[model samples]
Structure formats: structure tokens, C-alpha cells
Target: MNVAVSNNTTQPAPRVIKHRAWGRFKRNKMAVVGLVIMVALILLALFAPLIATHDPAEQDLLQRLKPPSKEHWFGTDDLGRDLFSRVLYGARVSLSVGIFSVLFNVIIGVIVGSIAGYYGGKTDSILMRFVDMMLAFPQFFLLIAVVTLFKPSLFNIIVVFVVFGWMGKSRLLRGQIMSVKNREYVDAARTIGMSDFRIIFVHILPNAIAPVIVSATLQMGGMILSESTLSFLGLGIQPPFASWGNILQSAQNLTVMTKAPWVPIIPGFMIFLTIMCFNFIGDGLRNAFDSR
Candidate 1:
């Protein structure tokens, strides 16, 4: 006291939200398993050549419709392409569609929703009404119409997905922003002369984004399924590109479906497993974000 000697005590570093979220996420066993499976699949996709036994697109009519064996692993498809290699490559295509499409959808949603929610006047009404109009339309039907009007190329398919996909996200983000805009920090940011953009983007969006993150994880699986459905219907990725959807299209043939079930079964199983894993991860994230 007399000396007033310095006692240099370092303050603890603040905990990051992601750190806490991860901690919560680790507590869920099923989610951890799903994460492991998801990572493995991604690795398979990344190192397709290294792991693959044969060319995915290489054809052998003699080997076609063969069931799983030690030599061929997953066996050959109707085109005599190695199912194992095709599955790995298909993972690459399917995941690419799911991830890239979501990126664009979220970006559009964030911009539109932030503008409408933060402004909250005639802008909000107009935007919300437009969202409602979109919501009234059947999304699958709309996607079909758009795809039918354009080529079934991968880029066009992704565009159709984005066009229909962003609407729900916009509505979600708008509601989140409306809830967060009236909060104390946002009001304080405004009072401190922060730009409207800064207040909206930095202060409001960050705080309200937990739900969006959960929604995005869940929607990724849905996106994959949609892409698969489109491909199966011959409205997505075309021949020469291996996707889970196109892979399953072999099952559309009654004889192939019944006689050579492996063609559809393997890809179908992969689709189901991937979607379940994604859903598990989504549930984990939701729980983590929702926890106090």
C-alpha cells in the first residue's frame, strides 16, 4: 500500500462464440459421429484418383451390372464404369452443388433481408409481400419451370436452385434482424454515429446469425437432395458427369432396378447417409446456438 507497487495481473482473454459453440457441439455424440463421416466423405471426394481403383467414366460392357466384389469393390454401373470411382467423383459434384449454391443463396438473402429489416417501413412491407408471393408458389414446380426454360447444365441448375432457395432465407434473416435491431447494442451503435451499414452488418447481423447458421447446415442436405432429384429427372447434371442423382437414374429402369439393385442402392444409401449426417450436424449446431 505504501509503495503502491505494481501487481501486473493480465486480464483473461474473452471467450470466442465459436469456441463455446464447438464445446457444445462436442457434447453431442451423434453429431461427432456425423462430423467424422462427413469428413471422410469429403476426403474421398478430394483424393478420388488416389483412392479410386479405375477411371470413373471408363466403360466396359462386359463388366456392366456386376455386383460388389473384391476386384471391383462397389462393382460396375450399367455403363460398366467403376461404381466406386464414380461414387467418389459423384461426391465431389454433389457437394460442390450443395456448397456453392448455398453460398450465393445466403449472400443474396443477407443483403435483401438486412435492407428490409433494418429500414423497417414501406421497404419492409414491400419486401415481405414479395417474399409472401414467392412463398405462395410451389418451390419444386418453380425450379422445374426455370430449369425447363433453360439448359440442364450444372450452372443453370445451380441458378435455379438459388432463385428458389433465397426466399426462405430472406424471410428468416429479416425476422432475425427485426428481433435484433431493437436490442441495446444496436441502439448504442446508432447513438455512437456508426454508419447504418456498419450498425446493420457488424452489430445486428452477427448477433442474429446463429439461427441462420443452423438453417444453412440443414438446407445443405436439402440442396443435395434437390440436386439429386433434378439430376434423376434429367434436369440437372448431364451425362459424362457423375452425381448421386444421375447414378440413381439407373434404377429408373424396372429391369435394372429389380435385377441389378446395387446400381441404385449404393448411391441411394450414400444420399440418405449424407443427409442424415447433415441433419445431425444441424441439430447439434442449433442446440449449441440456442444454449445460454
Candidate 2:
């Protein structure tokens, strides 16, 4: 009886950490719903070439300002462009802006942060001061100024956002790396004469990346909003290319709003829902990654 009890006690527990994380995420009903909605939106955007009925840029002045009907689902805009088609196509622009801007920021941030944190002296001070200098500037004004100087192209918008967007992330990642660099594994790697480059990239970065991933997720939504704001202000994506922001810009006239409220309403709702979904997913990811 004693031997059997000892054997039972010594039995290894079933491995369930991944399962637990997944279970926790699944249990968060809001997160699950957000995930589903986001996935659906992505699919809708991806297959838009097949699904969208009208050419996004085609204008039919004769059909201009028509209300939603069997022919044009979300109604026609001032130029008689299909609002539904524009909105569907706009998703691609908005999502691309968000994704590319975030990617650019993350790359720059991770590299700067890893170097600053791992080296930790004059390098850290100089890098952090630069980050501070960036923060001191009014982000929106700076972005507008930059975009105005360079022609307002989609690529230019992405670049401008990336330039301003990296500072906060760099600071966050610096703090995370500072905490992680002091771990025993890192010290052991150093002791074993691992090249600093290898140690930082192979060891430190993987551990530090989790928080950065969460931040990136949240930042994506902000990037989308920023892009929309810029586009609404007539400085992003340009005409012939529709985005939710550009759609809103077209509907800015009071008369237009009164006559064709759905013009702004549909795009506005999409922006709101997309951002909310990203935020919820980011929160859920943060909780999942929290070691405690």
C-alpha cells in the first residue's frame, strides 16, 4: 500500500500549459467573439475581388447619391461610386496601412531596443534620449508636416507613421530587455563566451518578444486609426483609392450627411469594430502571456 501510494505521488502530471492558455482564451467570450469577427472581416477583405460587385473607382454621376437598393447595397456616393464596393476595397487599404506601419515600427523598435538594453551605457542613454526627443514632438503635427513635405502617397504615410510610432515601443522593449538580460540563462550564455549578437538575438530577444508582441497588437489598432485620421484629413491613400477615412471625408458635408448618412455610418462602424476587436485580442494575449 505504501509503495503504491509512492508510485502514484511520483507520477508526472499531465502537461497542459498550452491547453490552459487556449482554454483561458476560449473562456473569454468577448475575445472569442472578437476573434471570430476579425477573422470574418479578414476573409471578406481577402476575397473582395470575387465578392465585390462594382469597381471601387468607377463613377456614375447619373446614379450619384442613390440610397441603398437592390443594385447598390450601401448606396451611391457623391460621385456615384458604389459605397459598398468602396468600403469593401477600403478594408484592404486600411488593413495594409495598419499592418505595414506596425511591422515597420516593430522592426525598428526591436533592433534599437535590443542594442540599447544589451549594451547598456552610452548606447542606452543616446538611444533613449533620441526616443525622448521623438516623444517631445507632437505626433500628429509632426506626421502631418512630414506627409505634407513628401507627397501623400500610401508608402509615404506608412513611412511617416513608422518614424513616429517606434519610440513608445522602443521604450517598452528596452524596459523588458533590461529585466530579461539579468536572468541566469543570459549570464550563463555570456559566461560561455556566446557572441553578443548571438546571445541577444537567439536568447534575449525570444524572451523579450512576448511583451513587445502584445504592444504591437495594440499599436496596430492605433496605426489604423491614425491612418484613417490622416486620410480623412485628405493626406492619406489619395483619391481613386478608397479607405474608410476617405469615405468619411467625402461625407463630412452636413448636407451629405443628412441625405446619405449610410455613407459615413458603414465605414465608421467598420473602423470602430475593427479597432475594438484588435484591442480585445491584445488584452487577451497579454493575459495569456502573463507568467503569474
Candidate 3:
């Protein structure tokens, strides 16, 4: 009897497995670095005003294209606005777009995916087909059309991103739900007369959302990239509102590029570094959640 009990107890509990996953995540040095970078950027964005020595929009043409120095650590742009200040303000735009757009994507995705996947058959066919059609469209042209139709602003950029972004997330979560909904525990939950909502969210979502979390994290970086691209194209938030892309736009002038190379370099570095950090964290999550 004692031997049989010991054999049966050998399997680890779910919480124990999760704790082990966290331990594994901590063991990855790159993940820790990414987390630190993410936190630091968040702090910088939140404290932009406090950290910036000058107003981001307060440009002085007289001091335009100045090199990096004590008075202007990141130098001045062609308009004479403080580059460091603009970069900090830009962080606010980038992080806001990334975070809120992902939030909208995840929420709408989880709901749509859960419904289609759990109900399956006609519902699944219709929704997945819609997702496919949306994905098939050339997104760049769509963005251009939409941005042109409306005045470009931070809110418009985020809204446009969320409108296009949720399709991918919905498809991802639908696949996860399809795989998870057939599990024995899920069947048991259904067998017990649990409400559909309870079965889908309470039981299945907890088990299935790990991948979605990682996807959202990675997507946040993509959102930042999109904002930068849009802003670079002059179809995003207009001037007077500094973002990384428009900040770099100053470098288009040969005088600014040569006289104050810092015009583009600093913001470019921030974008590169932020994307890398998000990718590192996504990789860490992938490794940590591997069932094997």
C-alpha cells in the first residue's frame, strides 16, 4: 500500500511545475537583462518631464544642429528643440502605443478566439476565414489609406494598429483554445454542467493564455516599430508632438546629419534596444513554457 502511494505521488503538482518554470526563467541571464531594460524604459517614459532639461517642443533655430554638450546632452535639432527632451517625450508615445494597443488586441482576441474555438464548426469556419482574409490584405496600403483619410495623431495611430492587430492574436488564441478545449479536464468541466463561460475562461484560459501573453509581449514591440514607421512616413503624429521617428526626421537635412549626427542616432538606438529587449523576453517565455 505504501509503495503504491509513493509511486502515484511521484508526479509533480501543477503549481510545483509553474514554480519550476519561474526558476528556469530566472536562470536565463538574457531575460533578466530584458526585464531590467523594459522597467528602465517605463520609468524613463513616466518621468520624461522631470528628466528633461528643456521642453521637447521649445525649439531655438539659433541653436539648431548643435553637437552634444552639457547644455544639450543629446544636442539640438534643426528647430533647436532639445533632442534628449524629445527622446524622453517620444518614449511616452512609443510605450503608450505599445502597451495600450496590445491590451486592446489581447482582450478582443481572447474573447473572439475563445468563442470561435470552443463553439467550433460553422462559427469557427466563419471567424477563421475572416481572419485569413484580413491577413491576406497588404497591411501597408491599408494603413496609408486609413492614415490619409483621417488626421494622424497618437490616438489614431493606436486605433489603427489595434484594428489590424487583433486578427493575428485571435487566430493565435483560437489555435491554442482548440488544442486546450479537448483536454480531459475540460471535458470533465463540461461533464459537471459548468457554464460555457466558466469552462472557457476559468479552466481553459488559465491553461492556454501562456502563449498569448508571450505573443502580446512580442507584439508590443511590433507596435512600436509600426508607430516609428508611420511617423517616419509623415503619416503619423505630426510635428510639435515629438516621437522617435519624427525626431530622426531631422537628420534628413544634410546639415543636421553632419553637424549633429545625434539627430537620428539616439532615437534609432532606443528603438533598436527596445525591440531587442522585447524579443529576448519573448524567447525566455518560450523556453520557460516548453512542455517538454
Candidate 4:
């Protein structure tokens, strides 16, 4: 009964289980395309003054409702505002609101969530209850009310968004911190007499930031859309400052939508494309970061 024991005794140490998230992200073609498009859009927005042929706010009723032609690529709006220029400038407003609002949300969320999860006592209960109370309200309606109370401007829009946006990130970060706080390294850090702040910020946050980055990307898209919605409702980035939403707002009249369809069409398409790109890239990031 010579049961031959196989000679492959070394089990290769499980290959160290490295997670190359960036490598995986690079491999996703849609993600790469989305990133490229986003970069191009940002560049266009930044260079709008140099690149745009005419002033976005300049209106010539004589040229109103002109169809797409060699001279005007996207054609002219009802007021004969240069569609291309408005779209380009709109990018600045939209991207600014999205980026800055997300920054505010992330900062507040990380601080609150870190404290709550690290302490895990009355602080957690109090903070979570506050979060829950906020969540109970209808977000968009609340934003609309708040923005209506303040003067309609880019700054006000960003402030309203940040006020509402932090809750979601806070909940997410709290969950992540809870999971990480029980890990061996966290315990070891505490055992070594590391301060609570040091343990949370140094040991835990680095590991927890993967999800935060992914969430932030998706949140950016949402914030952009939210700003656009507010503008469409005539409560964000008022006239003299072109935004996709304000452009679309002009199309509310059915007659204008039919005669000067390009007014809304151009900006609407840009918004759609921008959001889709962000969503694709966000999905890729999420997949790349997932450990399972």
C-alpha cells in the first residue's frame, strides 16, 4: 500500500494577498475613458475665457434660435446667447460646486465619524441621533427651502449642499471605523500607549480611506446634479453666470423648447454625459477597491 505522498510540500505562503487597486482601475477601459473626458471638460472650463469665441452672457436677439451651423457649432439660444460658450462656462460652476461641496462633506464627516466610532459611548449615540434626525427630512426639498431663504448664488448653493451631504459620508465612515477599530493593529497601537487620536487617524484612517475615496467620487456626481437641479428651479447661480441648469430653465416653455431646442439640448446633453462619466468611473473604483 504505497500511498505516494505528493512531494509538493511548500504551499507558496498565499502570495501575500496584495491588492493593486490602481492597477485594477487602469485596466478598466470605461474608467479610463471617463477620467479622460472629465479631465478634458475641466481643462475646457478652466480655459473658457481663452477658448470660447463669444461671451456666454452676450445676447443678440437678432441671432436668436439659430440652428447649428459652421459659425455657431451648438447654435444660439432664444436670447441668442452663444450655446457653446455657455456650456463651457457652465462647466466651471458645476465642477466647482461638486468639488468644494464634497470637500466640506468629507472634512465634517471624517471628524464626526472618527470621534463617534473611536469613543463608542454617549458621543456615538448623540451624534448618530443627530444624523438620523437630519436623514429623516427630504433632502432636495430641504435644500430648496434653505436656498430660497438665502440669496441665490454659487456660494449659497455650495453651502446648502455641504450642509446636507455630510450625513451620508458620516454614516459610511462610522461603519468603516467600527469594523477597523477591532483589528489587531488598532489594539496593538492602543497597547503601545498611542493616543486615541493617533490610533484613529494614523492606524485606522489610512485603511478606511479606500471606501471614502470611492464614495466621494460618486457623491461629486450627485452634488453636480443637485446644483443643476437647484439652478433649473431658478435658485442657483443666477443669470450673468451661465450654468447648465439655468440654460435648461429657459426651455420650460413648450414653444421655446420646440423653436430653440438647442438651448436646453446642448447643456442637457453635457450634464448627462458628465454624470454618466462620473458614474462609470465611480463604479470602476468601487470594483477595484473591493477586497472580496
| lDDT tens per residue, model 3, 1-292 | 5433543464344577678778878888998899899999999999998999999999698998888899999988888888989999999999999999999999999998999989999999998898888899888789889998999999988898888888877888898999878866776667668999999988788777878888998988998998888888888878899999887775788877777778889999999999999998988887787767
Candidate 1: lDDT of 7? 13
Q: What's the CA error at residue 46 for candidate 1, in Å?
A: 2.4
Superposing all C-alpha atoms, what RMSD in Å does each candidate have to the true structure? 5.2, 5.4, 3.2, 6.4
Compared with the true structure, all predictions reach lDDT values of 0.84, 0.86, 0.86, 0.85
Candidates ranked by lDDT, best first? Answer: 3, 2, 4, 1
TM-score of each: 0.91, 0.90, 0.93, 0.91
Which residue pairs in candidate 1 have backbone atoms (N, alpha carbon, C) closer than 3 angstroms, thus clashing? Answer: none
In candidate 3, the residue pairs with backbone N, CA or C atoms under 3 Å apart (3 or more residues apart, or in different chains) clash, namely none
Q: Summarize candidate 4's per-residue lDDT along 83-133 as a digit string, tens digits.
A: 888899999999999889999999999999888887889999999999999
- Candidate 3 runs further than 4 Å off: 1-17
Clashes of 1: 0
Error of 3 at 29 (Å): 0.9
Q: How large an RMSD does model 4 have?
A: 6.4
lDDT winner between candidates 1 and 2: 2
Candidate 1 achieves a global lDDT of: 0.84
lDDT of 1 by residue, 1-292 (tens): 3112211122111246678788999999999999899999999988987998988888999997888898789988877888998899899988878888888888888888999989999999998899889889999988988888888887887888788888778889999999878765566667668999998887678767778778888998999999999989988887788899999986688877877888899999999999999999999999887746
TM-score of 4: 0.91
